[model samples]
Target: MTNDSSRASGNQVSWQKRLQDNFDKYIRLVLTLANNSSQASGNEITWQKRLQYKFDNFMSKGGMSVFLALVSVFITAFAVMTTARYVVERFFPNGPTKGTDDLLWEIFVQLIGLRDTGDEANFAAKFVGVITIFMGLVLFSSLVAFITQQFESRLELLRKGKSLVVEENHTLILGFGDRVVDIIKELVLANESESDAVVVILADKDKEEMDDFLRNNIAELKTTRVVTRNGPIANLSNLDKVGVKVAKSIIILNDSKSSDNEQFKTLSDARVVKGILAVVAANGEENLPPIIVELHSEQYRRLAQNIAPGAVTTLNEADILARILVQTSRSVGLARVYLNLVGFEGNEFYFYRSKSGWNNITFGQLPFHLLQAVPLGIRHGDGTLTLKTNKDYKLSKDDEAIVLAGDDSTIEFFPEPVVQHNRIGCVERNQTLELETENYLIIGWNSKTAIALEEYAKSVVKDSQVNLAVEVLTDEIKAEFENIAKAYPHIKMEVMQVNMDSLDQLKTLKPYKFNSISILAGSGENAEEIDAKTLTILLELRQFFKEYSAATKTKVTTNLIAEIIDSQNTDLVIKAGVKDFLLTNQFVSKILAQVSQEPDVMSIYEDLFSLDGSELYIKPIWLYFPANQIGKLTFADCILAAQNRDEVCIGVRISSQAQIKNKNFGIYLAPTLDKDFILTVYDALITLADDQN
Candidate 1:
């Protein structure tokens, strides 16, 4: 039993030893496999997972993602390279070192699984890295292009609101002055029928003045869009602002309130003309329309004509005013009548074939044929005003019929020829009733004063008394009037030596309330004080005279002529209620300016002022006779009327409403074929003629 126990114990010990050895070996083997597997898996995941993480980062962050991805790829390649190089060097340290190309090829071959060893695997990793780098570079290039485009789009929206472009068919007036208002009024009437008309005024004056004038006087123009631009006519750049290149018609107004001196007027006019020429040249003649210029000096009209060959140049001052005074003075409605003769509305002078119905008709028979219209006169081949020409003056084919008709004038002839009515005898005054004239007070003096005095003398009746009141500032004037007083013994002339500035002294001259008093310029004074004093004295005289001549036909004519060193004073002077405030400086300035353009108008002016067949006379046309027609009548007809009765038809004014139907109608000139030209009460004036009776 002792022997058996010992053997069993030995066996157990042996078995235990064997079991312990096996367990130890097994544990070691298991640990080695786990470590190897973990290492291999970690290596594979390190390259691939790291590359994926970098790629994700590159996508999220535009620029940084590319860098991090590249870094990750390079690190993976290096790791593989290090392992392969170690294996190659350890295995074959003495062997020849491979060239860069051969090694790269081997790496590519290993990555594709065609080569053996870690060196080839390392090269394969590098090849994969190259492909990843190329992809990242492509992404970065696309990102840069997109970013640049976005930046460029933002810059394009900031450059589209400051250019000036004009529209078509605009009326362009090159200068602004007093005449501007008149012209604008005419244009307003002319354009009343059109769809749209734009008037553009180019002036050197302040825009406010132009705007205010237009607003106050031409409220109708506001709807039409009147544009006022600050521009000098002398400069092409300024002219462009007025859209002269696209203008329909340009009327060059000679400035009214320029320097009174003729030389200054000429200089300014020349400059304006030259500027107009330059603008026309630049715009090209074919594109430009008609250009009308105003001339004050009739002598300089040729010069103006030369500037714009076909343009109508008129002596604005001498022609317009002289006609007004000469015609309106004697004839009651002559001014109104004259306006119709030339105006576009109501009645106008027109010419037609005489054979229509007037071919065989005599002057007397014309009234019968033209029952609706009156045969006022006829135009012979030679222009003459033959009022008493035989009713049987043989009518010919070449003769043009001149007749006056209203809108309702009938074209049908009368049923029977009526005998001419006998004229009524005139009631002659018993003994030529002497016209009574009280003391005439003439205050302050000017060039116009002399002419006015001459006119006043001619206008005054024979037994009229006169007096001269002078603010004697110098010995020369005092002596000149004293000698004149001696010559006119029939009239008492009083010379006052008092301070015109002092209101008290002015009141002492009680003669201001005379039947006819004309306060002219203030002496030895600046324009402002002169204008102020003149206005004050005139106002006071108006009030005082109105009281004195309580039941008399008293006429007070004041002169606001030479006081215009500044044009702004016109408002104040006009407000004083002076009936005839002759603005001499304004008138003279306009005259000098106009004449500088057209010099030949002087003779026309002389004819206008004279009291003969050529004078400015308003003759009353007998439209009741049914043959004296003013509408569509020729100028030759007007001359014939004047020849018989010593009168002339110069201008015509028509009612505003009628102007619309006659679209091209204007107050300044007669229409070619207006059928409604009838003579009103104020058509023409009669001057002294040779008494044929």
Candidate 2:
């Protein structure tokens, strides 16, 4: 019995051992399968990621991607054709076979849907031919669709102005605003002498819209070709695309929409600074072209100059207009002279450098040598400009004549004097008048109002009265006026809130009592609306003056100086009997365009506009010549007469043509030496002088 029990225990042990070994084998198999499956899944994921990465890289190349896609389609088509042709030829021996080239050509023709399925002897070959035709249809359709899509994309890119400009020596303009059209118009006139001049404009605007605006505004482009590109001007890539490196000059215009808002103006000025920096980056500091930038803030202008030193030219619109306002207000017919001087359509400022003939000639005698040009100043070799120099000042070999001429080609240097001795009249210089206190009536208000007031303070005598009338006066405006009044204690300031639209309120101001009436452009979102308000006020004042003259039999001789924001309204203003009107946008744009052409003119204009140095004035004809010699004197005689008084006579204003808009208010600049002018005591002589007297 014991032997039997031991044998049973050993059998149980053996069965348990078999179960353990089997369990161990099953566990090993499961782990091995899971490891293999995990590795395989990871490899598949890695392969897909690599394929996606390659496809993204390939698609990033615009034109090249399309070309490669077409090549791949062709390659796949060839492979499929080879495989199908071999299967049909090898599998169905009964079918009629063609040469390799013929078979390939047949497949190509079928792929393009040019031919139907050809004859085949067996069912298998016929079946395969049907499949090939079906595959061809699908592949070719997809290929055509893809090509069409790519073509559309390329066209879209072109419409968006993403294409690079392949030009050199072009005038590159980097922003768009109200001043752009004026700048372009001036550039067009300036390029009339050049056969193939180009002006490229880049801005953050719609390309089509910009093109349309330019086309409608510029009636005649003359010899200039304007090309526009749409992009952020502050982008380096965009700067490169516009060929900044090869440009001759660049003009950066401020945002017109932001001109009224201080916050936006700050932002706009920052963008301009960024754009200037980007230009330097694209072209490198040493390779930068002449850059002309318009900045509202003085801080930005200083910053820009510091960035590029002598390479950058900055313009302050408000400051220029303010100085012009002060000068024009004091003179009756000086606005036309300034317009003619700064613009390209009329007499323009030019620098003439002569190698031999211009040396050792007095500043006053230099005008006698030139046939049509009038010398205003001398530019030294070290780049210092002296406008209205003394008559005894002699020109050196290194000096350049700053002359006003109709065109650069008309500026000629005669070795001998071309003086018309008969036309030269002898006259005595008139006595200087003392500066007197005056009353000024200013209607309406704008950003230039405060600056204009400051300019008046600089010129007006102590106890001069200034009356400001506006439709609405806010706290901010009141504060500004108070601050200006405090800053200039000598000038008397009076602010009144009057409804300018009401003629009764305007009549109460007694505008005729003032010496000068300035109608400023009102503030509004629409420039037309602002100008319309100014026009309304102007008409009311004129009617009131006419009626008052008839009722009281008192001669009212108050000069009207209107500030026009849009140049298109200049004619309307002139027609309304406004002899002295300022086209604010056009004037600033002219300066910017002129400076871009000749950077030295900026300093000349600065000197002319500032009160510290010489400025333009339209004095009475009696001031330059005696009453008896006025009618008999030629323009050259007047020029000589002005020289005796330390002033430069550039033109004459006739009182007869004062109301004629087409006659340029009777102002003739740089007239021929032989041209005779029958001047009167009432008529004025346009001259560059130290003071209004």
Candidate 3:
């Protein structure tokens, strides 16, 4: 490390020394030009040269020519119009005299007016007035029009998004991120019902850049007109420019690109909060729209909420992604289910007030009552959500049942028969205590590492051990681990320093022995680089598993899950038999986008994501199937069986080792109620029940 004096010596430089090094010759040349110009021209500048230089200087100012030309045209038009009015008055005294005010206004508007002047004209005076009007209009009107166009074009360049946005009750997105195009696409799907729905995005990026990015990504927007404005998201002027006050909902994207850096992420989060505050202030403590702001850290969620009390909601990306990873690491295809629900392109979460004489029934009877939708939970009028409602919980008329359906309009129940099971086969037995030791290898680290470890530890057995491997464990990383250890003592954490770039070193770890392997996205200068490193690590893991299995003469099997930053890179790691790919920003962005469309959906998101709440689980068929009931059972029987145990059977997961795109993953969500739902011993039933772990 350099001493303060040495650092000062390196930084400080006198102006004379700086000029002598690189700029002295150029400065002396300029000075010589000025001196020679003065001396050669009798030691004084000529009047013509002075005037020409002043005119050129004046012309160099932006819009100065347009201003001067408009002024000149205005003076010329005034002289021409005034002379025409005088000529008409003097030449035709008998002509009908109009007031000066009326005459001046008529002359000013006649330059661009389309109305015929023949009807108001009479003879020579009228003809002279019309001729004078034509002359001025022909010359000055064209000049003025050209000047106006040029000025407007200049203003359009400098004053970004200067036009007043007239959209009302539209969704407003306050920032731009890699997920913006996805959000816009989802909004387009959401706006398919209405012809005039608009999604106005206000970001710090250039308007043309945003528009081009969206156009390049999304081929067709259908009915949605997405308007982009380039300005500071936290600025009140920009908020008004995008019509935030009249917006129906707002999504504050934490587009803080460096999400791994704590200080930078927090600074970006502060900007989001400031933007929310500006919107709330603009709404005037009145009917503020539902604002969904994305914060990078959970510690700032409440801080943002306090900034704007009512209707201001926040989602912590790290915390939410950590929970999702922990949950999906155990159950394959569960992340797909979440992605489908949160994204508007597929079957999604819908809330409906049961008005068909079923409001007085218990929630357990909900599935049989709904059409093709399954009742996942209910929300009270007071804004409380019981996502996994108890079987005996009776819903009132004011309460709305949250259903997993194809569309919001299709949430009604159909009058169909609940097919009974013909033959009850033997079901699998349940294992109460998981005393078997499980090993987990966690590779790489990010802002979510500590939270993910804590959540993962909470879901694992008491003696379960976690082998953490990273390139370097700094004091900060150690501190994060200490915090996790203090929170979760059941998890035995071990740290290993290894170079992940070397495939041989990755093989030395023997990742297949672990019950599950998590390769987190490495934090670098940008998300693309981070994703590249993550992809590299994923390939190494793939090769490690393949070579190990080849050398040992065994079939390859391991629960591999990794975090992907960029959505475009998901395909690169898909062939590696990874159980789940957690596209962190894409999922959160979709949720925020979906919530912006329907504020009530936030409750569904909350109920589905909360850790302590009743969550969806992929329990082994042996755990749910009774001793006498197994094999090919109807989905209705599956539901009935789970209902008997006070649980809701949403779907089934058949293939344990499968990629996401493969329907062979055999994870059927919202399957037909009466269809034959075959449950093999290796398959698991996806049910909405208590967190069995």
Candidate 4:
């Protein structure tokens, strides 16, 4: 019995020693992982283990990562405490008060140390309890410190942004708003030519949430690496996180959401101005990278330029969109022309050094030399973009010809003569004098609706009429419309409040009489309702046009245009035989996308769209090409004829049902400079010329 007792005691002692060794090793392991960034030696570093190594490395780094490190420490301490108590109870069964696992509770509850409840064996409990109590206190204290530091680190990170970025020549996009996805997509396309491209986004949004949103929107981003930081982008201190100094370019978008109130919008614009100031200040005198900002008002845009001399290219996105809407409203294919000019997929503008053979040649003779490219303007050595310069204006040796070509590589001197290649026909030109009282009808209300109306008002003659009929709108929108009306006293403005869906209301307002009808995607609480309303109005208008044509026994040629929300729904409109529709919001996205790719492209658009310069026009084919002519007239013939008229003929738009897909919304841009096609009576020449020209 004595031998058995000795053996049992020896067994208990052996097991206790083993448990102590394991507990000590566990403590060492936990502390090693918490303190070290590398994996323990002799351990298999699987992908998971490698991930842990990376995670620990990240935690060791400065910024929010430090919080995770402290969290690791806290978790390790808790694990150590739990394991220690469990080991002590299992091995020291006799040393405890009873079979119940209550010693751990006592270790936690005990203030000073541990004591035994039973009087028979208080010594054993004292010896075992002292060491356990001390271990728990040390671990608990360390854990408390870790918890405190962890939260402190997190709060500090939230107050500031993440760590300073190390990227060089990266595009910095400030202010994440409605066009964020579109901007990113454009940047991605811009970077397609490069092997490695980086785009950093700094916005007043959660970084993780931004990441999730991007991932959701862009299922798979190709070569470009996108990084996001959470903080107020306009804040000067937060700007450093995006490495503004090394940025290739910085784009500041309007931050105000569509749902934001008028007061909030003003604040958002103020933030944009402040953000531009911050960027300029951050990079003092180091030749500040090209900064692009979108402000609402011309007053603010001019102010922004004054604030940052030669550094800011202020764009009024809403106003520019308003102009495009107005232009496209009257000209059927103007939207597609703008889209082609801005997108990277097709022909883009490139600045080319004038070839030696074409030296001292007149601008009129420029198109004959390069068969593939169409010269848009002369970008002088000093970078002055002169669009639609005088035909007699001679090209200087230092002139950089602005030629529209397929791509940068595709730009070269084509030796082939640019002549017409296809059989063509000519039709009688319908020549007329000044337009008779343009009656414009707008259906729906957007923030840009008033701007569109104001733009439209500028083109019409005195005593022209404008009718606005919207289903629903805010007081602010109405006030803006009224304000615009006051500016144009000659143009009679009329507002009709009625449900557009009601056929009787639609009948009361005869849309057929109007020279132009602009049906913007109707405003609604949701996109579905907006699209539904637009479709309904579109269908209703089609029915009215059909009926009006049948009753009058005359062809109704009222110019029709509609704004669509989704590009996919364009098919529905196409099926309805209403060929002209535009994605207005998407247009902004696409233009921003194009500009983000090549900043110089912005100059091309600026010149094309500016009111004081040459603009796109859908002039009749006979205006340049004489009527009663047979056989195909080549692009060269069109170019020479347009040059005579102080215009540049880029493409032709023919009324053909068979060539819908090939046509860019009824306009074709940069069709092989030599390619020729038959011209019909309804065909129009897409020209870039001043209105007076």
Candidate 5:
């Protein structure tokens, strides 16, 4: 029994030993499997992360980069399929052996979905064929989408006006404003004789918006082709894009919307200065074109000229408008004469340099030597203009005749003098009405008010009265008026706060008593609103005058001059019985355009508008022709008569045709010297003289 028990124990122990050995082996196999699984998982995760990072980076570079990446993937797929087919055919032979060219061609066709792998004996060849077909679908779809996106991107760039202009001798307008339409219209008229002319505009405005605005404003562009681009005017790249280097002329317009605000005007002037600098920098100093800039402040105007000396021509709008207002207020038909003189639609000033016949000719006789033009001044070789010179002054060799003609081509110097002796009537002496102290009325106010008042002080006789009326009376305005009054002690100045809306209040001032009434545009409003207010006041004044004249049966001869901000509203005002009105923006724009074409004319305008120089006046017809010969004399006779008085007969104003709009309000400028006119005693002669007398 003991022997049996010991044997059973040994057997159990051996069995237990065998069980432990099997369990150890199982544990070792389990750890080995876990280790292998972990390493394989780590490798797969690393590979996935690398692919993700590369894809993200490629996508972040934008659509073009993504498109290029897709193209690369397509090429890689094609290469892989081709190589795989080659390998399968060489290492593992297919059903039929194909040449290298045939193999590559077949792979390409399959990848593009043009063909399928038919009856391929090799399994590897079939697998690669299917993969290539799938990749082709994905890659081609992505490529189409990317190509469409690229096309859209290109269209967007075009809409933004990012393309450069390829033009030469074109007019480059650096900014846009209310004056742009007028400038362009004038340019169109100026370029009517040319076959093709371009006016490229670069402004901080939408290209489409500018195009639409211009299309609506200008009825016909004639021969001028307008191109618009959107960008900062002061940017060098933008200036280059507009072809600044090859430009014939450059006009920098002041921000008309900001003209009333000092801060905004300063910023606008700074931008103009920067734009001028940009133009000069873009096109070297030697290659700089004639640059015309309109600046509100005189300081900036001087600065602009100092920067580029002879290359820059600056315009002071306030000064010019003020002078024109004062001069226009002094006469009844002077505004029409100015309108006829400064624009391209009518008689324009041109510099005529004769080859030989004009040498040593007297200024008075030069008019007879010209066919259709009137000699107004002489532009010397030194660039000095002598306007309304003495008839006895002789022409110099370097002098260029500054004549007013309907067209430049019509300005011809005839070798023989043309004079109609029969139509030349004797100069008649007429009594002139003189008033030592004049009464003037100024309604509303603007930046031009003080300057106009100063001009009045210099122009009017001693003890002349000026009554300034306004809707709102602020200390600033009062102070400005006081300063002006202090400076001009010769004139009696009166300031009153009157609501222009109240006709009764306006009547209380006895506006009919004033010799001349000037209406100025108000501030703090857009041009349309300001013009509306001005038009309203004008209608009110006209109504009051009509009623007063009818009620008292007394003829009211008050000369009314209104300031019109928009040229579109000029016709409305004119129809409202405003014989004389200043189209502010159009007037300035005409001057700018004319000066850009001929910078020397600016001096002529400056002199013509100033008080110290010779000015335009409408004198009684009897002063130029005898009362008996009023209806029988020709325009040439009138010219000869004016020459006797040391004056220039530029035009005539007929009372019978005064209300006729188509007849130029009865004002004829640079009329044919032999054209006969049936004039009455009431009609007047338009002449340029040293004084009204």
Candidate 6:
């Protein structure tokens, strides 16, 4: 039992020694790791306190190592000294043999001298080892720092460039169309004060095509910044890459897909809307803004609205065609006049209440002699605004007045002594001269024809005449025309199978050199072939008109307007010298975007174009002024002129040479300081009161 107890004690001592050794090794390993990691982390390094911690660890482990090495060296020296002393005693216990004593003392003195030189060498070697170890640590640490900083620098660059990655307040406009240039032009006008306003366009087209278009056509966009990214709109990931969540608004363009017209529009717009909604949902509404959508059918409008409430949505084909029908039926230059009022280019619509002396005055009394500004119309609370109300219709205090030139700031004062106009001056006029009868010819037929015919009927007077020539006339459409033909016997309609491509056959109509012609899109399988055929027909028609006019010795005004379904193909027709080309595709998409935001805007527009007391007109502001004396008037002064004449000034068109300040890029509105007040033959459109009649 005693032997067993002793063995157990010995084992316990050995285990204790092993545990101490392990603890020491672990401390050393931890110190090494801490020092290496701290230096290698670079910018990610901890504070100075962590460095102090590492230094403390280094001192602990290093001191222990130095102490152990010193102990081993001391032990070796002590053992050697004892052995030398023992050998001396063994040879001569009492004293060194008398003869050997001298020899032993000499040897001992020589060894002592050698030991001093060895100690010097040992000190030098230890000093060199310490410096080498420190340098290796520094060199390794510095290499890690350089590699880490390089990686961090690249990350910093990426973070900085993320702003350019398309984010909030940036607008995304898709598709390429004839109206895109105009739409962008208006956006630049709208966002003039912003420093970093961005308009990014995503199109499945060559970047060069868009670049060339802007370079050649848009000179008005002087300083506007627009970026273009090329890709298909069908891909959700591609849309995400453009940074949809950061966008202020997304305008999904109609007619940018390859499929059936209605199906393609609905599908493509749906896809865009879905992608935007997904991103917005993931980003959260509090973070992501809204998107404006476009649709081809009235049926799809409801779906779009459901998907994104308050988003702009419209049936482009129907609304545009309806407007064309309404406006064209009015008169020539009427559409241009209407454009000034409703469009962003000219003067925008505004409301103000008449103050003081201007209060309670009839439309007739607010002319230039009394009020300093022109009174165009009034907008009511129910979203009804008239361009020109009746003359005797006295304006109340609550009435929202629409002015031609001035807004709320400049239209504050009313001149003293209300100016009155002579009633006799309003009536006594010479008999209206008889207008010469003119003939108009229309070619081609489609759904657009219905609107075109309605417009044509309204533009011409009852005394004027027109002839419609069509190929492939339908029985049902012909039946509808019978009722229209009954209303006007002079509107002769004839159908024939003659080919428009054949010049000889087209010459048979002899539509007079100066007659107007409109070419509408028709059913065709091959777009390129149809374009080629259409081009041939138009050239032949022009040639025939030129030769026939010269031979007949009759000069007539010929205006050609082409309706292109695809905006991308509009350039070909525009270059063909067509005076006016309307890309319905683009027009409809824009209308959707606008009405989606403010549906009542369309109502205001409709009222502007109506034939009631408020109607759009292009009466020269110069017509009402005295001979050659109207100075370069302020926007306030221009409004005064309208107020005096019972008219509304919507916009002003100046010559290319006119110099203006604070003008937006591609801006066609706002009069210049140096332009002559003399009314040019080419006039601008404003709203007029029927009371002037």
lDDT of each: 0.50, 0.84, 0.74, 0.71, 0.85, 0.53
> How close to the true structure is residue 283 of candidate 3, measured as C-alpha lDDT?
77
- Global lDDT of model 6: 0.53
Highest TM-score, which number? 2
Of 2 and 6, which scores higher on TM-score?
2
Instruction: Write candidate 1's Cα lDDT for 138-253 as tens digits.
Output: 54455566657645543331111011327567767777765565456556644556677788877777676678777875557533567777656667777776677877666677
Query: Candidate 3: worst 10 consecutive residues by lDDT?
Result: 426-435
Could you give candidate 5's per-residue lDDT for residues 485-529 as a string of tens digits?
A: 999888999999998889999888898988899999887568898
TM-score of 4: 0.71
lDDT per residue for candidate 6 within 131-189, as digits (tens), equals 43343344444445555765676565443322234455677776666557656766665
Among the numbered candidates, top lDDT falls to 5
Model 3 per-residue lDDT tens digits across residues 1-693: 469877777667564577676687888899999999878988677899999998788767856675685667666776787677767677676357777786666666565444335565667545655755676667666676767888779678645655668889899998887878778878888889997889998888887777778888889989989888888887888888788888989888886753457788888887887887788777776778889888876667888888667688877777777778777776666777677667787777777785565646678776776646778887788888886678898878788777777777776664343444443542322433254666777887776677778777777888788778888888888877877776767778877778998887787787888877888877777778888888778878887777878889987667788888777676776775566778876787788888886777876666667678788777677666654466778776677666655677877677643453767356677766777765677777778877663
What TM-score should be assigned to candidate 2? 0.91
User: What value does the lDDT take at residue 239 in candidate 2?
Assistant: 88
Q: Is candidate 5 or candidate 6 better by TM-score?
A: 5
TM per candidate comes to: 0.48, 0.91, 0.78, 0.71, 0.84, 0.56
Runs of candidate 5 with Cα error greater than 4 angstroms are 1-133, 256-259, 356-359, 419-424, 428-436
Better of 3 and 6 by TM-score: 3
Q: Per-residue CA lDDT of candidate 4, range 61-135, in tens?
A: 764576455556545644555565556556654453444356446554442334333354345455555555565
